[model samples]
Each structure stands twice: as structure tokens, then as C-alpha cells.
Target: MGDLSLVRALGRGNIPVAVTTSERQSKVGFSRYCVAVVPTPSWVDDPEAALAAVIAWSEQQREPPVLFYQGDHDLLAASRGRERMAGHLRCVLPPAELVENLVDKQRFAAFAERRKLPVPLTRTLCRGK
Candidate 1:
């Protein structure tokens, strides 16, 4: 869904884009906005390897490209390994702490409540006590 949105938004603006995916089967590569597709390991499966692959992919470009992450795993890894990837690619990501807070929904709920953010009321029911 994110890929489709990106293709539509960027393609309409005539912005060049390249996509990367661990699964060669990913249909995002077929999008009209995609100029190229670089293959990389799934961050969830092998974070270190994926990070290496991404950095290498960036190095091949004459200029660093703005990265667009598709999921929590990619976002977290990007935030944690920002320095390494920063040398070769431009990325816009939340700080590590914010990523952690969001990734762990419990922390996010507490934060939202503290900040008085509008969120649906939630209940935690214990299985047994």
C-alpha cells in the first residue's frame, strides 16, 4: 500500500524513484514510478546483512537518495544505524527513542496519555490474577 501511494505521489510530481526489496516477488518493482529496484535482505530476517546491503546500494548511486521505509523493522534499523547509512544516503526518520516508543505500543499509549493526545480509550484485561 505504501509503495502504491509513493508511486502515485512521486510519479505525479515527476520525481525519480528507485525501490529496494528483499522479496524479488514484490510487485512494487512494477510501479511506473520505479526507475530501478535494488535487492536487499529483509531487515527483520537479518538486520546486519540488510543494513550492509542497503549501505552498499547507496554507495552505488552518484548522489545519495532519500530513503522511504515501509515498516517498523526498517524504521527502527534505520534510526539505530543512521550513522552508517548517512554516509551514503539521505534518510528522514524519527529519533531512536521515538521509534522505540512507537514500536512498543504500551509505551506509545502511555506517552499519548501523558501528552493528552486524542486516542480512543483503551482497556487492558488481565487473563487471570
Candidate 2:
């Protein structure tokens, strides 16, 4: 999904892009939209490892590239490792407090409600002792 948009943007700027996928099947499809396709590990179960791998890949590039995150889990893992990875890559992310508030549905709704903003009706569900 991100590859297509990135390819289009890079093409507009005449920049070369490298797309990495974990699955062999994904490479064929992504290759058509990217300059190169590199196979990477699936970071589903181990996010730290995935973050490390991506950080390592970014460090190898001579010209720093913009990184875009498409998945919520991946975004969270990257946020947690921001201090360690700050120098190696650039992450376009919302403020930490904003991200935190948005991720928690209840907190987000309550905040919006407090401000008299338009938010859906929300209620907490609990198990009584």
C-alpha cells in the first residue's frame, strides 16, 4: 500500500526507491511499483527485531530517505525505540501525547467530549466485583 504512493512520489522527484517485503510473493507485485525489492523478516511477533532491521537498512543509505509507517503496531514499536533510532532515520509522527490519547479510545472520546467537540457517544463497560 505504501509502496505505490512512495513510488509515485519518488517518480515525481526522480528519486530511486527501494521497497522491502517479508513475503516472496509480495516482491513480485511491489517490484512493478518500486526501483528495487529487498526481502525482509516478518516483524509480527517480534517488533524490536523488526525495528532494528529497518534501522540498520536506513543507516546503510548514503542519502537519508523519508520513512512512512502504515501499520499501528509498527508505529508503536518505532515510537518506543525513537531515542535509539533518532539519529539513523527520520520519523514523521504526531506528538507522543497525541498519539497516546488517540490510541486509547476512551481517553480520546473523553478529551473530545470535555472540549465539546463532535465525538460519538461513548461509555465504559466494566465487570462488577
Scored by TM-score, the top model is: 1
lDDT tens per residue, model 2, 58-112? 7878855566666766677667778867878777788777776776788799788
| lDDT of every predicted structure (CA atoms) | 0.80, 0.68
| Candidate 2 TM-score to native | 0.74
Please report how far candidate 2 places residue 65 from its true position, in Å.
2.3
What residue pairs clash in candidate 2, if any at all? none
lDDT, model 1, position 64: 87
Query: After superposing candidate 2, which stretches have Cα over 4 Å from the reference?
Result: 1-3, 27-29, 38-44, 127-129
RMSD of each: 2.3, 2.9
